[model samples]
Structure formats: structure tokens, C-alpha cells
Target: MKKKVIVSVAATVISLSTVIPLNVTNPAPTEAQETQQQPRYMTRAEIPAQYKWKTDHIYSSKARWEADIKKAELLSGVFKKNYQGKLAKSAAILKKALEDYSTLSRIQDKAFVYANLNADVNLTNPDLQAALDRAEKMATAVSENTAWFSPEVVEIPTKQMNKYLQDKSLSAYKYVLSDIIRTKSHTLSQDQEELLAKLSPLSSTGSDVYSRLSTEIKFPKITDSDGKEVQLTQTNFISFMESKDRNVRKQAYEAYYGTLEKFKGSFAQSLSSHVQSHNIRADVRNYKSALEAALIPNDIPVKVYDQLIHSVKKGLPLMHRYMDLKKKMLGVDELHMYDIYTPIVDAEEKYISYEEAQKQVMEGLKPLGDDYAKILKEAFGGGWVDVYSTDDKKSGAYQWGAYDTHPYLLLNYQGTKGDVATIAHELGHAAHSYLSKKEQPYLTSGYATFTAEVASTLNENLLWNSEYKKAKTKAEKMRLLNQRLENFRTTLFRQTQFAEFEKAIHELEQKGESINAATLKKVYGEINKKYYGKRMAADEEIAMEWARIPHFYDHKFYVYQYATSFAASAALSKQLLQQGAPAVKRIKEKFLEAGGSSDPISILKGAGVDMSSSKPIDEAMTVFEETLNELEKLINEK
Candidate 1:
């Protein structure tokens, strides 16, 4: 039998793909120019009608949403009758109940999607809000009603379940039954399970409140580059960060973090409560740590996490070398934090328009083969993507979709070099989902977070490689290589630093230490110093950086996967590019095709990667070192 383990609430609530807190900075505009520029905000009707999904067909009115809610409420009775006390009976009934569950789930998903998409756009709309509220309640009810299936299946005598699985009619559910039996050790009593289920909403309230506060609360006024004061907000902070003037970047950083500092205690409390919730849930079940609990669901080995931190720590010198190169390229006497983002290339590439970005993404991804490229092209051409950033637009980017519909991507597309990379990154996810949905059963279509970043990062690596080869001059090549290294350092090293900080805090909590703002800052400062090494000054405010990361509040220890996935992708991309179609085919079949059908390790091993060894991480770091060498050569030659 598989080893017995308990899953924690953190494993469920703090999964990957949490929000990234980006500081937006709008360019300082002259009064005349400000008058000339059109308002950036778009009304619901003004938003291109094509971009909105045809939700009328799904639910024509609020009354329809209510009716569906009623139907969903009615499903509890159906589920109870069909699934309760019937697991010991014939296999046909079990199969029928599973089918029923899947069908009802599809309906629930559609209803929730319909309500959520509309409400997200117009948060103040009462009808949409009501629809969303109803949908959430219905979902919780369904979760509570279905909670018994796993425990009951596990409670069935193992011999009996195995015997049932051998029957011709029940063999299809062999994996499903096996998984249930494996979870027997973690299953709580019906009352305890119900109580936990009911507490979920309240437990999640801290994260919900943090989201509202962060996104909706007004920030203070700050002076811009021209010395004119303007109100700072999440929307405008991006433009500020990308400011051409160093003073502006510094000012923006101070102003933005100043706001977070003012509310640091609030943010700290929210995050601490979130971690505490995870600890409590993990303790209730039988898990060694929140990290172990988080890994159990996806069967990711703990060593993978350790390897990521260790390898990235070993690679920090390479990063510091890259940092030094950036300073030299910029011809600065001393590089400040503000100088890191300034264009390293004298003739930086122009921002690609959204249309051009789409074409470039397709061109860059062509090596993935025609069928995959074609689906991406269709997604780009179709209104599946909500492109472009606007005032009050959702911050950051994501690939979102219901299992039944074509994947939809929400991008805050500003026409920048990084924006082009973002396009490739998000479409990587879209293509992965598209392929998985087409290739696997609904049950297996959704992949765990571990493999999710591989596809996305692979596309990014491809785009960088394609762009690097096409550069005309040494400077251009250096610039492209610099950008690539910067991506690696930030996505891999910086995120690992975050992972380390998260682990430290959780361990502190586990040790019965109270987590407050001062403690968070001190711990974060130490981790930042350790990860970045002594080469660069670890700014005190960088400690407050923890408060700004939404991932910590929502996803505990999830950032490490970005480091691991990218490292694996870097290695995979190298194999595919140098070794040819056979390697590419192997990756597509073993990594992409396996989807969630197998454990992450098995899936990666099938793709010719063994995370148990340090080879992939070593290869990725070697790439970083090589790129650093190339940058050094370019500088010396210049």
C-alpha cells in the first residue's frame, strides 16, 4: 500500500499562482499633454464587445443565476442519496455516482464562471455581486456534501475495495480507488470534516480582506520626477518603476513602500493569520510541517524544494557578477536599486504593439510544432485574450478559464520588451491547458503547479533564444543576453529568496514564535542578505518587501516551484534546441502529455529529468554562468 499521509488546509488554500504585487509608476505628464491624452479607463460597454464572452447564453439574467443556484442546492440531496452509504454496494452505482458528480460539477463551474467574470469587471454591480455570493455558497455546499465520498471509500475494507477493483466493471476506477485508500490515514470523522469545511470561508477571510485592502484602498500623494505631487496608486506605480529618471524610480519606490510601511502591521497580521491557519490545519491532520503538507497533495519530493534553494544559493555569485555587469554597462559610478531596471543597451528595442507581440510570440513558438502553434495563433486571433492595461484594470497577468471553455488570458499589456515576454509566458500556460484539455480526460486535464511553470518558462526561453540569435551587433546580443540572465536571476534567485523567507517564517510560527512586522522585517532582511550575498546593500525597506508579496498571504512556499520549473525548462529547452526533434517529441509526450495523470517526479523523469539529482539545477546555473561570461566578454571587447 502507498505510504499514509495527511493533507493540510494550506495544501489546498495556498497552492501556486498567487498575485504578484507590482509597483506601477505613470510617466510625468505636462499639464497640456495631460489634457491631450485620453482617459485610460474604459466603461463596460466601451470595452470591445467582442472581448466579453457571450454570457447571456450561459445565464440570461440574475433570475437565471438564482434558478441555477437553486438547482445546485438541490444537487446536495442527489449526491447524498447516490453516494452516501452506497460505496459498499455494487460497482455500477459507484461509477454512476462519479458520473453524476462530474456532470453536476460542470454545471457548477459554468455558473460560477458566469457570475465571477461579470462581477470582476464591475465590482459594485449588486446583481453580479449577488450572483457571485450565491455561487460561492453553492460551491461550499457542494464541497460539504461531497466530503464523505473520500472517507467512505477509504473506510471500505481494503481487501473488499481491491476485490471490487478487480471486477471487470470497476477496473476503470483502479487509480481513483487506490488514491482514496491512500488518503485513508488523513480522513477525519464526518463531524470534524464538516466543521473544517464550514470554517473554510471564515479561515479564508483574512486573505480576502487583504486583497480588498491592497487593491481598493487609496495610497498617499508622492512627488514625481518633475517635482509635481500626484496620488500614488497600484495602477500608476508600474509607470513609475519604468521611469527613465533614477530619481523618479527612487522616489516612487520610497512612496510606494512608504504606504505599505504605514500599514505594515495590518499586512503582517493578515499574513501571520494566514500562516497560523495553515499551521492549525496541518496540525489537525497529521503532517510534519506546512511545507510537507503542501507537497503531499502533488507528491512533490521535499528534496526538490531544498535542491532549488541550495542550487540557487550556489548560483548567487553568478548573479552578483551579472549585477556588476549591469552597473558597468550603465556606466554608473555606483549602482543604486533604481539603476537595476534602466535599459542596459544604448539602443533598447522598441515596444512591440500587441498585434506585433502576438506575431512575434507565434514566430518564436513555431519550434513547438504546427498543431500547438496553430492553437496559440487561434487564441491570439480569437477574443480569448483580454489584452492591454487600463486604469483600475486588474494588476499583473494570468491565464484563467473554466475547464469546458477555451482558456482566457488577462494581461496588463503595456507595450514594453518585458510585455512581449509576458505574452510568451501567458500563452505558454494557454497552450499547455489547450493541449492537456484536448489530450486528457477532464479529471486529468488540470496539472499541478510543479509542471505548470515548465511549459510557460520553456516558451520564454525559446523567445529569448530566438531573439538572441537574430541580434545584429555585439551590443544587441549583450543586451538580449543581459535580459535573459536578469530573467533567470529574478525568476529563479529572487523567488528562491522568497521561498527561503517563507520557510523561515513558517518555521518560526511552528516554534511558537509570534510573527509581527518587526520580526517579519528582520527575518526577511536576513534572508535577503543571505540570498543576494554581501555584494549589494540589502536595503532596509526591502524587508518590507515581504508585506508587498501577495503570494505569501495566499500561497505559502509556492515561489520555489518557479525556480525549479524554470531550471528544468532551461535544461529541457537546451536539449530540444541542440539535440533536435527527438528530444522535443520526448518532452511533449512525457512532460506535456502526462498532465496530472502521474506524479510530478514520474512525469519529469519520463521527460528525461531527474529532480532527485542536481543535474538540471547545475545545468541551469551553468547557463547563467555562461551568459555572465558572454556579458563580460562583450564588455571587455567594447
Candidate 2:
């Protein structure tokens, strides 16, 4: 099953490793405080000159990106005028059109990436923000103009296209054309498709407005555990939650949710509009439901979604046990939401510097074969990663690249254990992109979300396993195990809970039921209860959790994929670690090389997983159970 997380507020132009909640804002510290505070902006000069490879692309300056934006605008007319009605005349024409479109798209990709990267570096810069907005609008306009291309290609008579494929001139586009034909069943009429295309901007307006408000609006002040007042900006709020102090975590949580509660009605409206947009589009395309329509394009089976939810639901008892163990380790009389963030075993919490983290990550991933490890080592050594978080730096980490350019990772690295894990995660994405781009054609390099998170999560699992084994003391081992369980619970079970809420909301909208703040809270509250079980209180503040999540506003029913992918990753990582070379060979051949050449299910099956059955999910749940049992045993012994 696919699970959605929070979506970035800027442009939904490219796929990133993960989605940060949009409300995550990092405002500039006041001038008086600036002297004492770390510089909010990292100067380019401050970046090690040797690490220039961290950003391989040259479109770094806003002025350069603005020039590229103009260049992209020039190609808009070419696609708009030439390919409109001429697509169906001949196979040769179709092939040429596809080539031209791909070339234009590649150029646009560079421009959009440049703009976004620039904007992300400084959200306070108006010029960069304008550049991003203009580039996205241009891309959308061009996309709408070319909307007829796919439907038209799909409308071509199958026999005629088959005969055309027999000619040598059209053979290069055989796969592309076949993919178009594969969508024949989903294509709407030309007029309906055109209408939907035109309406898309309007339809997405709700999300756009929500993004603006969430990212730009200021939140009220909240007190921290130290009795110091801090502004509840997006960046600080998340930082506060990650605090080792229980009181600080609780204060941050309540403060953030309290702000969200005030805007609950607006959030509900935006969410409703997004859901309605999906339902209407699915209906127009003649699908049974929005979920089916969303999955169909990626060739995912609806049964996969069903099996994921069902299997994860069956694992709820394990989650409850894990929570209970956590409470016991914390020496709390009762486990409240506040106790969740505290580390299980007390140690001098180490902060691995970015350099050390990179070195550790390279060592941890050695099991993926020497070649894989070599590339990873080069990535670190060659400056492929931008580390260190500064004020106005993007709030989260992500790996991004065009097929023509090497993958680059942007990280807001805070020296925390979680930050080390994040380094592994982003590099996993970079490695996957690197391998896919090396082995597959550009057209096939980008896989769907169903398979995308596997590589990243696998690296994280490997890192955790390595760390767990290396710990010397029982306290250290228990601490590492606790951290691992926390990751599983948050990434897997928590995401599944989010998925369930998304599904319920979509269903309600489909039934023409009005979605308001009260209704959303009630529904989410119930799902919260089910996932957490009876071990912890489902605090009323938790109901507003849905509103705080930006994913619900952007991607429709997308959170489940996180749970599914992490489950798949756990199983794959265990096999590779235990079974060695044969497992590694199978993973590389079946999963990595398969790319978008086959559906996700087939790819996973080839790599020794069957999402069609409940085996993988069940096995993942079993891992969770074992971890919980280990924690329980440790607590009892203590």
C-alpha cells in the first residue's frame, strides 16, 4: 500500500526522497539575537572549496536561472503549435513529437530544478521565489497545451500502430508508444481531457493557497522547556519535537497543534478540495474510486493496498507492546504522547559530525557489493552531498538530479542520531538514481513511489543493523534497539494510520459527505486509537495531527506507500545480510535493474517478495514483534 507524507510547499515538479510537512518554516532570528545565534545563512565561501562537488550543476545563481526560464519559455511555442493535431498522422510523426517533447522536458527540468534549489536555499528571497513560481506556471501552461498528446496517441487505432511499428523508422519509440496504448482504457474523450487539463490549475488552487498560508504565515509564540519563549516556526517546531526532554517535546507538540487548531477550518476546506478533485477526475475517467484511478496509472493492483492495510492492522498488538516497553524504559507511571520522543536508555547522546556520518554510512553500505560501496565512497569524497543546516536552508533532506546531471543531495543536517540516519536515507535515493540512470534509458529511470522508498529505507535498515551489532554494553544495545523500533513504528505503522485516514476521508468525499474540522478530527481520532491500541491515550490534540500533516493537503491517499516500502526494505535487507551474495545478486538484477521495465509487484516478486500475498507485510510485522519482544525482555531483566 502507498502512504503519503507531508508535501513540500514550493513546486511539486520533481520527486524528492521524502516530503517535509509544508508548515515547517525557519524564520530569521532577530537582529539583536543574530549576534549570539549561528549564522542563519551559510556563505558559499564557508562551504569547503574542496566540496564544490556537493552541487554539480551550474544553474546556482538566481540570475542564471532567470535566463534559463526565458529559454524554457521559447520551447513552449514549439510544442504548442507543432504537435497539437499532427500526432496521429504517422508513426514517424509520433516518434518525432515524442523526441521533441522529451528534449523540451529535459531543458525544463534543468530550469525548474535550478529555480527550486535557489528558492530552497533562501525562502526569504523574493526574486528566487518569483523565479520558482514563474517556472512552474510556464511548465504547467506548456503541460496543458500538450495534454492532448497522450490521449491522442492512445486513441490511435491499435492495428495501425502495430503495423507502423513493423517499419524500421518507428522502432525506437516502440516502448513509448506501447505505454501510451496501455493507457487506452483510462483515456477520456479529447474534449473531456482538454477540459480537465484546463481545470487542473483551478483545481490545484486550494493546495497552492494552503501552501502559501502555511509556509508564509507567522504562528503565535510558545514557551520552551527552558522557560524561554520561542516563535513556533516550522523548523523550530520539528526541532523541538526531537528534543530529548519530555516536557520540551510535549510543549512543542501542543504549541504547534494549538496553532494548527486555529486554522482547522481552512485546512479542512483545502483538504476537501484536494479530495474532491481526485474523485471527480477518477469519475470522469470511469474508475471505480479515486484510489483505483491513482494506482492504475502506475500499474499497482488495488489488492496490494488492501493487503497492506489488513496486514498492518494485524500487527497493532505488536505496536502496543512496543509502546508499553518504551513507557517502562522511561520509568513513567503511564505512557503519554510526551514520553514517545525520549530515548529508552540513557547514554551520553553522541553527535556524529557530518564528516563522521559520511564515513560511517560508506562502511555500513559495504554489503551492497564493492561497486556500490565504491560509488558511495566517491559520492562522499567527491562532495556530492551538501551538509550542515543554516538559517533559511531548506528544512529537510532530499536527493535530486536530471538524467544528464549527477545526483546531488541537499541536507539540513542537525548533528543528531536521526540526522545520521537521514544521511543514509538520502544517499540511498542518490545511489538508486545513479544506478538507474547508468543502466536504464532516461525514460525508464524514474520509478513510481511504490518502489522508490525501498532503496533509501534499505540503507537505513542496514545502518541500524550495523550499529546494533557494534554496541558494547547492554544499555547501548537496548538504546539502539529502541531507536530502531521507533523508526519502524513511525515509518511503518504511523504511516499506515495516516493512509487509513486519507482513505476514509476520500471515501467520505466520494459519498458526498461534507468534510469539516470536527468531522476530520473525529475520523483521524479513531484511526489514531486503532494504531496506538489501548496502551497509550489517544489525546484530543492528536486529532488535530491530521491538520498538521501537509501530505493530506497535497497527495491523495499516498501515505500508505511508506509503510509498504519500509516493510519491503526490512525483508530485503534481512535477506541480503543473512543470505549474502546470492541475495545481493538477486536484488541488483531483479529490483535495481528492473527500473520501470515492469510493474512494482513483478519487480518485488523477482527480488523475492510477493505483495500480492500477505507474506511480505506479515514478515515485516513479525520483525516488529521480535523487536518489541526484545525490548520487553530487556526491560524485565532490568
**Best model per TM-score:** 1
Residue-wise C-alpha lDDT for candidate 1, range 349-387, written one tens digit per residue: 454556567778888887787777766756665555666
Instruction: State the weakest 10-residue window (summed lDDT) of model 1.
Output: 6-15
Evaluated against the true structure, the overall lDDT of model 2 is 0.72
TM-score for predicted model 2 compared with the true structure: 0.88
RMSD of each: 5.9, 5.8
Candidate whose lDDT is highest: 2
lDDT of 2 by residue, 296-343 (tens): 877788888888888888888888877777777678777777567677
What lDDT is reached at residue 554 by model 1?
A: 61
Global CA lDDT of candidate 1, please?
Answer: 0.71
Candidate 1 ranges with C-alpha deviation above 4 Å: 1-39, 42-44, 50-65, 124-126, 220-231, 235-239
